[model samples]
Target: MLDSVRLYLRYVVTSVRSQMQYRASFIMLSFGHFLSTGTEFLGVWALFDRFGSVRGWALPEVAVFYGMVNIAFAISEAAARGFDTFEALIKSGEFDRYLLRPRSTALQVAVREFQIMRIGRLCQGVIALVAGSLAVDVAWTPGRVALLMAAIAGGACLFSGLFVLQATMAFWTTESLEIMNTVTYGGVETAQYPLTLYREWFRHFFTFVIPLACISYFPAQAILGRADVLGSPTWFQWLSPLVGVGFLAVALRVWRFGERHYRSTGS
Candidate 1:
């Protein structure tokens, strides 16, 4: 496993170096990504400026949510660029090369591409998280800090699962994946706020369905020492990482099923 990880790292570095061959275009694309996501943070700031709070959650609290979601998203997009753009892979017949390899399909698909441009977005997320941490009045504890890191890691896994699921859909049809975007991109947008801010159905969709909030809001409340207005037990907040794991498990199962279908149908 360690050797495999090292090989994957080398594969990613190679891809990054290849992408850097076009230095000017790469820099412009990276800057474009930074500016696009920076506008998202600006939108959040504007919302806070217009309204002191959203559903009683303060600006710093929402920033925590925004930062965590974006951080997870950037990490997933960078590492899982292949699965994230699986439709193109299928269309371009690149997935067939993955099948020819003896390595795990998932790992090969994961390392097939690496979006170095997303480093800009990742940097933005780091800055936002640090600034939000400074702005919030949370009592810092070692356990809480650990939970924050775990939450970010779990969220990244969960979002990667969503990307895999989206890619898996290519086996069936490749018209347009606007519907999956609701879960992938839309989930990111919705999760950047307290889960309790949403209505009952939306909260339930997130908790029992996608569970994006499990990685951010619940763990965040634990870190912030805030009460769960959504009536989730205190222990649920501590155990929220499991939700992301569970989502990933389900998504992987679905992806495997899709692979079987693709192999059988040759589509």
Candidate 2:
């Protein structure tokens, strides 16, 4: 485990050094990311300005959800960038090189590239989350704080799972990968708001199926001291972080299946 961590660190350092070769481009790309996601924040603000609240959830409460998801997403995109962009790796035969390595294929794929630029988005997310917490006037208890962090970690894992699942499909065909973006990018957009604001089917899909709500909505309810409207019990809300491990397990299984398929077909 320590050796793997060291290998990943070396890979990250190498990526950062390579990115630094084009300092201007890196700066511009980072700024562009900030600008794009910053616009998302404006949309939330506009919604709050027009309507005092969505359902029973207020703007500040929703910001917590937005911030948590964005932070997790930024971190995931930065760390799991190689998997996130796996279609290119497969197309360019880079994934085949990964197979030649003695280390775990997943680990190799994970550390292949790291996007330092996404730190800009992460900074913005932290700011928004802090502002939201202050705006909502929620009392800070140790448990509440821990749960909030867990929610963010869970959301990160959930999104990372989506990326892995998307990449695993590359073993089959990369022709229609855009469809997978709906779950990845679309889920990010959807989870930014309170899940209760969405329709029953949509909410149910996120909750019971994709389990996006497990990271944000359910935990948010506990943080805000509200009751679940989706028929989930209170204990589940506190246990939302477990969803991350569960999602990763399923995604890994799917990935292994895809790997086996690729080996057999050589496609």
Clashing pairs in 2: none
- Candidate 2 lDDT by residue in tens digits, 49-85: 8998877778888888888889999988888878878
Model 2 residue runs over 4 Å out of place are none
lDDT (10s digit) by residue, model 1, range 35-77: 8999998998999999988788888888888888899989988
Misplaced by over 4 Å in model 1 are none
* Candidate lDDT (C-alpha), each: 0.87, 0.87
TM-score of 2: 0.95
Candidate 2, residue 253: Cα displacement in angstroms equals 1.7
Residue range with the least summed lDDT across 10 consecutive positions in model 2: 224-233
